[model samples]
Target: MFWATGWKPIVLAAAMLLASASSALAEEGVPTPGDLLAERLDERLGEQEVALQAFYAARDGRPAWQETATVAALANALRTLDADGLTPQDYRPDTLVAAHRQALAEQSSPAARARFDVQTSQTLLTALRHLQRGKVDPYRIDPGWEVPIEAPPLDLAAISQAVDARRFEQAFASARPSSASYERLRASLARYRHIARQGGWPMMPPRSQSLRPGELHDDVLLLRERLAILGELEVMAAGVSAGVEPQATEPRRYDERLVAAVERFQQRHLLEVDGIVGPRTRAALNVPVVTRIDQIRVNLERARWLLHGLPDSFVLVDIAGYRIRYFRPDGDVWRSRIVVGRPYRRTPSLRSSISHLTINPTWTVPPTILREDVLPRVRRNLGYLWQQDLMVLSPSGRRLDPRDVDWWRPGNVILRQRAGPRNALGRVVLRFPNDHLVYLHDTPAQALFAREQRAFSSGCIRVQGVLELAQHLFDDTGTEAEVSTLVAAGRTRNVHLERPVPVILHYWTVHPDEEGRLVFRPDVYQRDAALLEALDASPTR
Candidate 1:
């Protein structure tokens, strides 16, 4: 019905209508493109809260980025965005609610269970309680290895530095206390010193200075308490014989024997071998019984957040102490020492399921590995690949005549290694698809397990006991007997998997044990500072 001139008017009118619609959307809280992107990030972050909360609780006895703040920020974003109209595609409030209810059902006692439910609900509503200002957890490990004490002349900087190290010496040096208060503190120190005289501190080697700023908040407190408690533990350990067993020998153990036992306990707890108890060890020993109870509560919260909604089975890699643990549906089933990636090439945090396992696996070297390690060796000596039993393949699938490509040119080339005894992947590979290009595999370098410190891999975990692990995974698949037979033969057999387990590569440097005693592990990867800042600045729920 319109001519060419009439069409121009129609176009203008359409343009106006579109602009009006856009304006209306803006007024209704539909964010701009930039804001929309932020919203998307917030959405994904919201989903990550469960795992994040678990990590936080494990590391600091509370969520690093408080759940309360997160939830509040999310709510604000939702309000600003008018998310009701947009609607979340993959998220469901009812699903979270159902999960909450299921967790509540799992608690054994009604009162205890109610408390658990309250905590969970708190996490949901408030975000989380992150950093409590000025209230440092006494259980944390010392960030600085040693506190620098100021002597005759007061060095304020030196005193402050020492105070930061969790050393009481600095406290005394910095004391501007009233005479009465000073006297009281002096008396406490004297009492501590008296205990130190009778019982030596749990002697521990000088801890490395590489620990991250905030990863060990709870651990620092625990360490302090452990130091306090060491005197007691020493007394207990020196004299405390193993409790009488109905099926066993002695009715009671003597005090000297108990001291010996305490020494053994010190060794097991990673404390120094000094037979004497000092202030540090004494403090650790004097940990109040109530603190252990608190540890249990914190660990419970962690389990609820981390393991509550998880799949039936997965691989858990504890990065701090460099250990790998496997969990089956039944219970705490299996564990092994693993050589994780080095600090420089850190293993990542991710969730993926192992889809397959390859026996006598051919190693198709990842591009990064080739560039960083293999290529340099190849350049230095052409025989490097042949020595390692590796083969160079062209894109066309032919054996790359190494002569064809200019050896000196930076280029693209596929490198594969034939499976044999010398293969880097050793006898097996657990395949899990992930962005980190990581997997669990056997390593030819098995001797590294003998060292106390084991952070030496490129990124993949080099498991110490792959043979046993393989047997365990293949038990239900009926391949365990066959695998064992193959191992006996020692010639290597390539076997594909029938079913694969899930692998969760995570980074947690602190955790509590069954006895509710908080434990410390080396923070092999430094990743706490940025996280701490993020935690501190995050909005409160």
Candidate 2:
């Protein structure tokens, strides 16, 4: 009876529409189907209050279309839904006349209304962001989706298999390096593997008999052996975690060569490289198979997040691994092994835009350096400033008497000091506005970069290839030729940048190679443990 009652008015309205169309046909001015449909849809869904009340009432039965919570909520939903384009299923005066009455009835029923409005008002904002990003389709609704309370991206399938196997060998043998710096580990193994394949072990770098360092020979040999073990572990670990067939082709088992292999893994990871597997070494090895996978995923997400929207050129410093990479929009163009600050002077993580580059830049000893370094020296020796080639400057750039100003006075330490050849900043300063007071600059201590582990600076990054970087930044200004000329001239020259490229100093504990093999670097700042904990605790993968 109710359905029949609703159909009567709708059918009458359709008849009236047919008569009107016949008249329009006689007048030779008939509206197009698209135009007529647009008008009808707009009438049904375009008006804010009416559409909202209609949707609210449609959810349940209401006898009278009066102002009610259901109507208010439906109106809110209609207003919030992305309206770039939407269609209405019905639009006829007769149909609307009865449906409108039903909407009123629906609005009156409390049971018809939702307890809480689930439609977010930010749908328009999301669509706008997508449009700015050049998205095509605006709305994609999936009714079958269920919200996840918590999940991890780790390969649970492999982990389940690993657990099912009930063997640490499967877990350990299947592990692989998960950061960029570990590429050398793979390379080193390849070198040795090739040597072995040729039926000979590679010769170790010769240190003379006279230079026999005590307590170092066995450890060095052991470290080399450990390096080999790490390579084997990586191949095994990756294979197991990938749920691929085990590549356990090694004639020598890691357990059989445990003493030597564990040592090498420790040596490379910067843990105590003792042949014995202690708590620290075990902790390093015991990094859950899932944890490393999660770490790689997180780093990939971060790389995507940071590098996705960057300009055509930018310099990024990864602190946890103590390396800086120069990337063009095309991809990574240049990279270098960098020595970041020590634990005490840990390099900061930040976002910065490079303001300028000063070639042969003079080091202005910062107050922290002055207090921690110069002041202590001044206290030790009265002639410390002159000995170090430091010039005391007043606020006006005039040289102040080092003796006149009380070295120990808190006020005296506030003065800016001009640095000369022997200054802390060796020859250049890459300037950026950052509160960390850190920058990429030349260091007089060039030999430190040559060390295997380059975590040597205070809080700044020490570039191993500073001149190469300088050349890249000053491509337009003949800085490359100028720096070359100065070096040949055997004199230091200060050159200012014509245009500076922005440099970002960041920290990444893990990164991948071109082949997508993940490598792990030493947690130079000891950041991995905490990050690992956080990653494990995250509700989302």
Candidate 3:
């Protein structure tokens, strides 16, 4: 209990009246400030009462916000909650500020001061919690999403002492996400908001056919304006491609410079870099700025799920972008093109640690693939299994002849592909433990990676640089040499890593490019609507 349990700042007469009450509190046991808070919290947030009680009980009834006197320092930071794609209305800092002013003016008792402190601190804490972990539950949108359910560990004592030292703003600032990646996304979001205020990007006309160089049309002029607005083309008069003077501002020819600009836009949008405005490129051009804004918000929500406690070194597989980024202490050390699951058989978002690597791994046909992909082919052509070098295995591990089983009837037999060139698992596999049973592996169908949209796999990820990834994962030890030795032996081999590396398979459809410009990827699984719906609805359940 505080030394002056009932002492209150008041006029001389009220001060004298509190002297006897303060002495009486000392005679009896003073109710802890934590108890006073728990009493009120039990009425509003019953679930949080225990945690709040434990947090303040250790402080011996002293108020955490008593010395801070005002919350004026937190006004800007609180308002930034909206900039970070969160609703500032739900976590209003003004409420706490008003409470602090009222508590300071209270001339009733010392217990009154303590209760106000507890209530204010909890509101501040609630705001910080919502900032770090978004209000919407990932499981509600997609049950397969492996959300880290563990709440962020609270540093209540430190926060209390910091507030007591009049460092309330700095104390709560520490509670926001600490990931640089998330900060980058937030910065991009802010920049886009600025762009939105400026009337957003130029909208191009929907081209029914491909636009080629040397073509002069009104649509070409519109394309030039749009591209120039997006910073991919220089704003110049028409006929530059033909090296002729133009009387009007409208473009009269698709010059080489304009072709180069279109190519750059194509590259940025993850389309074929042919400098031609085909259907795909035209579609990318037509995506509205509002949709991109929603994409940024959706990805911001996804980022909150993993911003805390990231491994210093890890492999990030972006399923929607179909790419893998290996991050080290410095930054992204390596990257690779990848193929993820098809739209109907979407890959799950998961976080796990890479345990080991396998050389010449055999591919087991999963039940879903066996039923959907192989059975149709096997029924149409009996020699499908032989051509693919796959075999049927009985329950007792006996290799059954393909003719012995009827392809039309679903059976308990397993389809296993031998470790060879035709095997879908390819030459190497990076194994990780997760309930989804998915892993990163090399693919014999390397050509698939060159396509603009690479979601062709059943469920597992097919990496273009799996061998390079294996070499890097083994570089921590002399395992690189051992891996070479094992590959030379030409057999199925499992190589344990010197230390397991954390792997996160996530979906982020919007991220900034190297120039800090926001880049958007197609939502292959059509997931943005559901996430946007969740974000639009009240996050508080």
Best by TM-score: 3
Worst 10 residues of 2 by lDDT: 84-93
Which of 1 and 2 is the better model by TM-score?
2
Candidate RMSDs in Å, in order, are: 23.2, 16.7, 6.0
Query: Candidate 1: deviation at residue 243, Å?
Result: 14
Runs of candidate 3 with Cα error greater than 4 angstroms are 1-47, 54-60, 64-76, 93-119, 147-154, 161-172, 234-252, 328-332, 477-481, 539-541
Candidate 1 stretches with Cα past 4 Å from truth are 1-124, 127-232, 236-305, 329-332, 403-405, 477-481, 485-500, 514-516, 538-541
Score candidate 1 by TM-score against the native: 0.50
lDDT of 3 at 67: 47
What lDDT, from 0 to 1, does candidate 1 have? 0.50
Q: How much lDDT does each candidate structure score?
A: 0.50, 0.48, 0.75
Candidate 3 lDDT over 1-541, as tens digits, reads: 3434544343555877777676677568785434555455434433456667666665654446654444655544566677667766665566767766776674634556656656665666666676677657788888898847444776778766765555655665576677666778888777667767877776667767788887877777778767765667755423343354543443557767788988888877778889888888888887876776788888888877767777778998988878898886455478888999999888899888899988988878888888888899999998988899988999778889888897777478888888978888988899999987899999889899889779998889999978878888888534544555666777998888878888988887876665666667888888889988887775351
TM-score of each model, paired residue for residue: 0.50, 0.51, 0.83
- Is 2 or 3 the stronger prediction by TM-score? 3
Candidate 2 ranges beyond 4 A from true positions: 1-231, 234-283, 290-294, 297-301, 328-332, 413-421, 476-481, 486-499, 522-541
lDDT of 2 by residue, 19-111 (tens): 888778757876644344334433443444432434334433212223344333333333321221111111111233343345336343322
In the predicted model 3, the residue pairs found to clash are: 241-255
Q: Which ten residues in a row have the lowest lDDT in candidate 3?
A: 1-10
| lDDT (Cα) of model 3 | 0.75
